[model samples]
Structures are given as structure tokens and as C-alpha cells.
Target chain A: MSITWPLFIQVTLRLLEGFETTCLIFALTLVLALPLGLVISFGSMSKFKPLAYITKVFVWIIRGVPLMLQIFVVFYVPRLIWDLPAFSRFNAVILAFVINYACYFSEIYRGGIESISKGQYEAGQVLGMTKTQIFFKVILMQVVKRIIPPMSNEIITLVKDTALARVIMVAEILKVAEEYAGYALIWPLFYTAVYYLAFVGILTLLFGFFERKLSYYKV
Target chain B: MAFLEVKNIKKKFGSNEVLKDISFSLEKGEVLAIIGSSGSGKTTLLRCLNFLEKADDGVISVDGNLLFDGSDRSTTSDKNIRRKRLHFGLVFQSFNLFPQYTALKNIMLAPEMLLKERAKKEKLSAHQKREEHEKIVAHAKELLDSVGLSAKEKSYPCELSGGQCQRVAIARALALSPDVLCFDEPTSALDPELTGEVLRVIRNLKSSDRTMIVVTHEMEFARNVADKVIFMSDGVIEEAGTPEEVFDNPKSERTREFLNRPGF
Candidate 1:
């Protein structure tokens, strides 16, 4: 019960193990969601009314409801309705996180794309570049440049939101801290904050680096 | 047949007709200047020539090849439209250079892409394609030299002045080797002091055999460079003739009124 440095190190290392799971959820969600969001954004901005409307409504429903509820549904609904086997707990958490974050990222992508002036497209067209060429070569880099700040914000939030996986018994850092708290080890609970702050701080620096790299595009 | 021609072109946006019975023809090596107040459809007419705005009714022929027969979409196949677009290049008033690319790359991109497309069409071997690509890069460098921006080839659009950016845009347009080059008030976006640099570039291009259609407010430059001058009023060609006839002795009352207006 003595608050020894060695004891603190031992607890921190154990919490770091759980934090690895949190980091995995965050990284995988981002890797899967970023491009998925772009595809979804295209659907939302489709010229076809039925397609665009359907995508908008789907995004609206996902965003309107709570993430925790979405996780619960993702975890339990398939087996309940179809008498099918449930997904593994980690996979269920990832599925919920990917769908939820992809919708948010889609809105950011949509805004970034729409904010570009029509002149850029016209310029590309006049240069005899095809629509695909224009989108990839001219528009995509600019969109990336414009969306990075907002995307970083969402990604940082995702890092914190990974704690939500504990609701499904995923044993992420917060869950590990909760176990310690149950044993009257209150200090370990606050220790999780340092991990989160350090992770978020590194992400902030990384995003700032990206913003600087894209500075050549002043518009 | 003229090198480029538009027959009875008409365009309307909603209930407002922007171009009414517009028609013009340009011979190879001709420099035609279109002059009008804002809303006179000068820019719209230029855009129509590039197929940026499809006319409600018209026929456009570049080098006597029909690029558009507005009533028939099937004849204007996507491939044909794209091929025909290569015959004309447009420089925007706003410059419209890709902000992310350096000046050299801006000039080089379309040419390189088009060369690759052409290589596919011609079924060239890899060695032949590399040789052809080298030629394009050489031509792109020549274009930059012509625009007098050889020193700033590596500068992005934001790093360049408005005049410098416009010049880079001109170089980009020329890199495609179009039969005709069109300008839409190329200097209007520049400060008064910066206008001369761009106008000088355009003026140097006047003697070249590349057919040019310039929509400009600089009456003096137009008089000096244009083989033909058109006065547009209310979406129609009020008068058109040699520069001397249009500027010094305008036949139409509207043309005279516009020419005589203060600050024109």
C-alpha cells in the first residue's frame, strides 16, 4: 500500500498494455474510415437524387443516435434478428467505430470538396483533363490540404472515444483503470489521463506538421 | 472554310438570353478582339467556343471539323468533344493556375498527359514514348521562356505576382499547342501597374500564326494587335470590322457610343 515508484511503474506498464488495445482501435478505425468517408461523401454529393438522399438519410440516422447505442446494436442486433453468431467483441467495437467515424469524416470531406471554387474544375476541363484526372490530380491534393485540420480534430476525438469500447467489455485502458479503481487503487484511474494527453499531444504535432507541408496552397 | 467558325450560336440561362444569334469566323493566324461592357456576353461567347457552356443552338467547326451540332448529342460524343477541345486553349481572367503545382509543372501537366494519351492512340513503344515525352518537356520549357518566367519555373502560383501568375497561365495554355488560343479579359484581374506585363506577353504573341481571340477592355492594345475588332452590345455583335473602322470610324451608333464613352 506504500506509493512506491516501482509500484507506480508496474501499474503504468499494465495500463499501457490496455492502452495498446485502445490505440489499435483508434488506428484501425482511422485507416478504414478515412477513404470510406471519401466514398460515402461522393454518394452524399451524387447527382442522382435517390442515391444522394438515401446516403444523407443514412448518415443522419448514424449521427443522430449515440455512438454507445450504435455499438450495442452492432454487437447484438445481427444475432438477435437473424439467429446468427455474434461478431467477436473486438470486431464489433471496430465495426461500430468505423461506421460512426466514417459518417463524421464524410461531412468534413463534403465540406472541403464543396468549398473549392467551380473555377478549378473548369480550369481542369479546359486543359483537356478528364473528370477522373481532374479529381485526382488537381482537386484531391487541395481537398486533402483543406480537410487535414478538421480530420485531425476527428482523429484526436477518436483516440479519446476508444474508451467507449469498455462499454462492450473490450478491456481497453479505461476498463483496466476501472478494474484497479474497484480494488481501491484510485491513483491508476487518473494515470490514464497522462496516456491520453501524451497521445493527443503527439497527434497535434503531427497534424501541425501536415498543415505546414500544405502551406503552399494558400487558398 | 474558316479555320474556326460558330454558326448562329445562341445561349440562354433560364429566361435570360446571354448570347443572341452570335456568329463569328476566324481564319488561321488571325487575331480577333472582342470588346464589350460587362454582361455583353463576350466571356460567355469565349466559353461557348471551348464548350464550357453548351449553346442552346449552334454549330462549331474547328479546322472545318464539326465539334458541336448542338441539337444532336450523339454526334458530340465524349471522345469527339475531348479531341476537339484540344484545338482551342482558353486563358481565364482569374489566371486559374493549379495552386498546388509549381509554374513549370502547371505548364507541363496537360502536355505530358495528352502525350501519354496520344502515345496510347499511336501504339508507340516505350523508348518512342520517352523520346516524345522529352520533346514535350522541351516544348514546355520553351513556353516558359516565351512567357519570360524561366526564372520562376519552380515557384507555386501563390509565390508569383498576379501578372506572373497570368503569364504562367498563358504558358500553360500554349503548352497544349492548340490551333486557337482565347483570352477572357486576361488583364482585368491585375492591378493597373501589373496589366502591362501580361498585355506585353499577349502582344508578343500577336505576330505568331496561332489564331487568337482576345476579349479585352484595353482598346489601344486591341487596336494595335487585332486583325478584326468586334463590338458586342446586349449579347449581340453591334458592329465588327478592321480596328480602324471600328475604333476610328464605327458604323453602328451603338459601337460609336461605346467607343466614345469615357474611361472605355
Candidate 2:
């Protein structure tokens, strides 16, 4: 039960590598999901019946199933259906993460867009702006302002969910914890929670700063 | 041809036919006011003129451009429709300004982007573009001055009152230099004192060169400002005539019931 300071530092450094992977997935998923969610929200709210229905159904299916099932499906479904080159486990993990978060983000997208009055659209059109221009210049920032707090909450959750990647042995942070635990035991497993809580705390501070900076915006 | 025209326009929204074969036309400088009870399609009809809501049938041509040609909705290109849309300006029931942008930037954006292509088409040089920016920004300032909101030039929408927001919305619309201006309940979201402020701004634009169409519930304002009044109910024009003709005379029971309300 003797404390081992040098080994502890090494274990922390090893865990840092896993934390980097976690941050990578977190950042990439957000980079992909924000715009993808906007596009999905647009399609779901489109005047075209077919595109609207398709987007809605797609989001619904992704949201309905558990993330674990989505992870398994992404890993196996393409190979089963196409018989093409198998995807790397990392690719499957990203695919599952993107699709799952995109759906959640789409609902936030939809809510933010819908909360804007139809009058805004009319005003944009009357000003001779195209629909796309209106969405970006007028509707876009409002949607961002509206969705940020909710988006931040979901995003921090996504940071922790990177451990879920370990379910498929993707070698993310939790996997790094278990690896160290086999050699040393006990506390390393508990140490994994510290990384998550610290990451989430940082995320919360960032979101608070963002919201304050955007305070001038009013719908 | 009239400067703007709406011919036999019909619009239905999800089993609700809101406008049935409505037709209207306007010269370049006239102001037309539309008054009706709630669900009377006054707003819907105004929306159709700008192609904000596409009419299920008939045509709305602005500045002689075919905005809606009664083709299958799928066949109509949004791109083509948008080109015609630049011909009109609109103010809404809620002051739908881009809340994040300051009043100056709110008015500057559409002109900067949409008219950048326009400037290129006209082959203006960079010096001319810079000059145009100064002129536009000044014009926007002048517009706010006319509307009594010049002091609020740098304020966000949240910092302004509802009336001031509506005035800024009007200024933003005017910055487009559109052929026609449309108001959907300009005072509906304002308090009485604020409503007077907004209506005063709209009233001062009486001598403006552009045409105007208003969907308003303010009978006194409409009776004073409008050359003619078009009454709507149940997705159709219940009656159309001068304010005196429609408000004073009894043509349709619906219009009668509307004007006879405690205030009107």
C-alpha cells in the first residue's frame, strides 16, 4: 500500500494520451455536428415533403436507438452490407459518435430555428435576400445564441462519453485507465473519474464565457 | 403595366385555404391599406406578394418579374423567385431585426452582399463601392432620423423599445430601396403609446416615392393614411373600396362585425 510518486506521474502521462484522443473526438464531432445539424434541421423543416420526412425519420431513428447499438451497427453494418474493405475501429467509433450527436444537435437546431418568428423570414424575403442569405445572416446567429447552453451541456456529456468508445476497445481514456490498473491496481481506475470531471469543469467555464460574450443578442 | 401586381392569387395552408382568388395591383407611389379581423388572410395575402408564402394558384409579379407563375410548386425555382423578391421591403408584426447586429449593420448587410453582385453587374469600381457604402450608411441614418431613432444607431435590438425596433426594421427595409413596402401588423406588438410612435414613422413616409401595402388593425390610422381599404375574412376579400366606403357602408356582415367592435 506504499505510495509510488514516479509511477503515479507516468500513469498520469499515459492517461494524458488517452485524454488527447478524447479531446480529438470531442472537437471533431462538434466541428462536424454543428453544420451537419443545421443542414439536417433545414431538411427536416423544409417545404419539400419528401426531404422533410426523410430527415425527420433519420434523426428519429438515430435518437431512438441506444448509442451502444449504434456503435455496434457502425462497426459491423457496412462490412455486412457492402463486403468492402473493413473500417478501422477508430473510423467506426467516429462514425457512431458523429451520427448520434448529430441527431441530438439537430433537435437543438430545430428548436432554435422554430423559436424564431416567421416574421423574421418575411422580413428577410421582403428585403430581397435569398432564403440562404436570411438563414445565415439573420437566422444563423440567433440559432447559435439560442442553442449554445443546450449545445454546451450535450457537448460536455459527449466528452465523458468518449469512454463509451472503450466499449469497443478504441483505446480512449478509460481504456488507458484499465491498462495502468492491470500493472499497478486500484487507484488508477478511480483516477479516470478525475480526468472526466476536470474536462467537464473546463467545458462549463468556456460555455459561461461564450454566453456572456453573446449577451447582446436578443430574439 | 402597374409597378406591382397580384392576379387571382389563392393560397392554402394544410387544408386551410387562407386566400381565395385575391387580386390587387399598385402604381409606383400609392399606399394601399388592408384591414380585416384575425384569420382574415390579410397577412397571408401580403406575404404572397413578396413570395414569403407562395400562392397555390395565380401570379404575383413585382417590377414585372414573374415571382409566382402558378406552376407546380416543385417546378418553380427558388433562385428565380428570389431575384424578383428584391423589389419589395417588409416590416413585420414583431420587429424582426437581426438582434445581434447593431442598427447600422442590420441595414448594411443585405445591401453589402446582395448588391455587391448588383454593383458588379453595374460594373462599379471599388471607389464607387466605398462611396455607395457611405451613401447607404448615411441614408440609413437619415431613415432612422425620419423615424426618430437616429440616437439609437449603434444600439442592439434588445436595447431599443418595441417601437424603436420597428422603426429600425423599417429603416432596414428602406435600405434595400425596394419598389414596394409591406407592413404586417406594424403596431400589433407595440403598446398604444409605442404604436403611435411607429405609426407616426410610417405616416411620415407618406410622400415617399415607393409604394406601400399595410395589413393593419388600426382603423383610425388606416382611415387616415390609406387611399383605399380592402377588407378580408374567411380567406377572401369580403369587400374592397375607400375607407369611407368600406368602414362606413355595410357591404359584408363580416366587415361590419369587425369595424363595429368596441374600439373601431
Candidate 3:
């Protein structure tokens, strides 16, 4: 079989449109998850019993369910249960990814926070720092540094999982390939691997740079 | 009431009483050494006065202002007692210098944020604030000089030796210039040789008019620098008196036996 440049360009342009959707979901999830994860971590660690319990239970439910199922539920359940108009397909995909990743990030947050010794907290108190000051000024950077490796792994996984949105025909890269494959030739289906491998490849290097920047943490 | 007073202070960990009716007082500039074996509740008493432990039942006063009564340790309405704590400084055995911060930032943190947080910052004019900041830096330098850590300002805690770390801890404590400095086993973490190095710095502090309360096992330190000595055991005061009277002629059998031993 011969490699064809003209056909490649046609598929690449169509794939690019689908790639744009993937990028949008990735960007939105990060913006939402970073702060939302912090809020969830705080809730899980709250001194009040009820808030802590509720946060933990919510995290457990989200984490236990499949992301594909969650996407379906979040996208379709409101329409089914309430007989209301459904959210836009793109919005539903974003909402699902945000909720899923936030739970994962919360666990990473909890593990990072718990890894720091209790002695550190007592030391902060002895200096007369309020609990807020201790968390932000003392423990915050350490948690960020500690959570990066696990968070990066999940993020790369998230990039690939954007293809999961194609399940609902949201026109992700793979779905774009499916359209072109049926029309022109089936080879574009194989070409979809090019986009995925490239996306994941770039993310890997970005995480490497991020980890190097945080090397001062030493832990 | 004395310059610093503790009355009926009790601390318990779920029914295992760490301190029972612990009471003591100190005049300004006096060095009172609290000596006892491990688990004697010596550290607990010091923690109580600072409201670090939140005593189960107690009344504590500093400079004629009651700090902790029953449960709450002086709310915003009780500014006088709050003022007293700001005047108290604590040094610990572990040196507790924030691992992430430089020594200079560690010393400057409390005075800078604490005053700003309490809104007493208006007392300092911009010129004075800059001057005060410079003075804290200068004083932190002097304190580091006094404790023999002048070369270690930029180093993190992990890079420093145990002796250097303890000196930084002392510098961090003295940076506040509190009315009283309370040490909770300050030398317990160091070897015998390094113990002398820290004790020498502490002995140098004796000539100044600052009040000090030292929780220690070093009998010689208690005898050499203390104006008064307190021996505690099993959550209660066993004996307390002038250094000479307590060490030279101990009244309690417990004190005599404890002093003669190599360890407290």
C-alpha cells in the first residue's frame, strides 16, 4: 500500500476539528478540577463530622462508577428523570470529566496531606500561626509537589479518555476518523492512533518539565 | 498574683491525667528550672500556660491579666490576656524551625503577621515598620550571633547540624523578645557535648533581665543557672525550692534520689 499525502491532509483537517473538542474538554477539566479538588480535599478533612462524611461518600460514589456510565448518567439522566431538555453534548462531556477527575484529584490531595507528619502541624501552632496560615504557607507547596506525579499520570490518561466522548458522537478525533473512513477509505481508522500517540507524547514531556520545576521539594 | 501565675491547672488525655492541680508562679527575670524524668508532666505544665494544651481546669495570669479560665483562653473581648500570650515565647526540643523557610523568615514571621492580624499594626508607622523590620533582622542576626549560628541564616533545617538547629530555634524564640522564654526540653535532643554548647548560650542569657522557665534533666544546669528549682513526678509537684536548698539539701526523698543519679 502506498502512503498518500492528499488523503492524509483531508483526514488531518477533519481530525483537527475533532482534536479541538478534545482540547476544550481537557482545558475545562483542568481549570475546574484544580480548585474543585482543593475544595473537595478540604471538605473531606473538615472538622465537622457531617460535611466530612458527605464529601467522602460523594468521592466514593464518583470513583466507584465507570466514567463512561457517569458521562451517560450526567448527560441523559436529567432529561430522563425530569423530562427536561438535556445539556449540550459538549457540556455534558465536560461536566462528567470534571466530576470524575475531581474525585481522583481529591484522593491525591488527601494522600499528600496525610503524608506530612503531625509534628509539622504542632510546630506551626507553636509559632502562633493560625490553621489557615499553616495550611497555605507551610503545607500547601509540599502537597502540590507530592501530588504531581500521580496527578500527571491521571492527566495523560484523561487525554486519551477524551476519545470516550465519541461514544455519544461528540465528534472527537476517533469519531472524525470513523466518518472519513466510511467515506474515503478505512485507513483513517488506523491513522487515529497518530493523533492519540502525539497527544499523549506531548503531555508526557510537559509533566517531565513540571516535575523538574518542583524538584526543590526533595520529597 | 506574681508576674506569671498558674493556679489549679489540670490536663488530661481521656482519663489518664497528665497534670493534676499543677500550680506555680514566677517573678520577672527569674530563672525557674522544672526538672523531672520522662512522663513527669513537666512539658505539659509549660504547654498549659501558653494555652497550647487548653487545660481542663485552670486559671492562668500573666502581668496581672488572667489568660485561661475554665475552657476558653481569653476571647477577643479579653485583650489583656491575649496581650500576655503575645509576650510569651516557647522553644522546643526538636528546634521546630520551619523546614521550608529560611532562618530569617522564620524569626520575622510571628511579629510581622501577628501584629498585622491583630490590627495593632497601626502602632507602627511606615518608618517604624521598616525600622522594626530592620531591627528584627538585626536582632535576628544578633540572636544568631549569640547562639553561634551566624553563618546559617540561608541554610534550610535539613542542611544544619542538631546544635545549629537548636541555636536557630533559640534565635527564633528570642526574636519575639517576650517577657518570658519557656524551653521544653531544649537540650534533650542533643548529645552531652552539644548540651554544654547550648547551655553556655542559655547561661549567657541569665545576666539579662528576661524571665525564663526551663524544663530540663540537667541537674547541674538547674543548680548553676536556676534561682529556683521545681522537681515533678507522676503529674504532681514533688519538691520546689531555691537551687541551693533543693540540690544541696533536698527535703523530699524523691528529689534526693533523682539528683544523685546520672539521669533524671
Best by lDDT: 1
DockQ of each two-chain model: 0.76, 0.61, 0.40
Structural similarity to truth (TM-score) of each candidate: 0.97, 0.85, 0.90
Ranking by lDDT: 1, 2, 3
Candidate 2, superposed: residue stretches over 4 Å from native: A39-61, A69-86, B1-28, B56-79, B119-125, B233-258
lDDT of 2 by residue, B27-141 (tens): 7777889987888898888777777776788877777766677865742557566666777777888878888899878878787776577788999888888898888788778
Give the per-residue Cα lDDT of candidate 1 at A71.
94
Q: Candidate 3 — which residues are off by over 4 angstroms?
A: A181-194, A217-219, B71-84, B118-132, B260-264
**lDDT (CA) for every model shown?**
0.91, 0.83, 0.81
Error of 1 at B94 (Å): 0.3
lDDT-wise, the better of 1 and 2 is: 1
**Clashes in model 3: which pairs?**
none
- How well does candidate 3 match the true structure, expressed as C-alpha RMSD? 2.9
Estimate the lDDT of model 2: 0.83
Query: How well does chain B match by TM-score in each candidate?
Result: 0.95, 0.92, 0.88
Q: Give the winner by TM-score: 2 or 3.
A: 3
| lDDT by residue (tens digit), candidate 3, A107-144 | 89999999987756665666666778878877887778
Number of clashes recorded per candidate: 0, 0, 0
Clashing pairs in 2: none
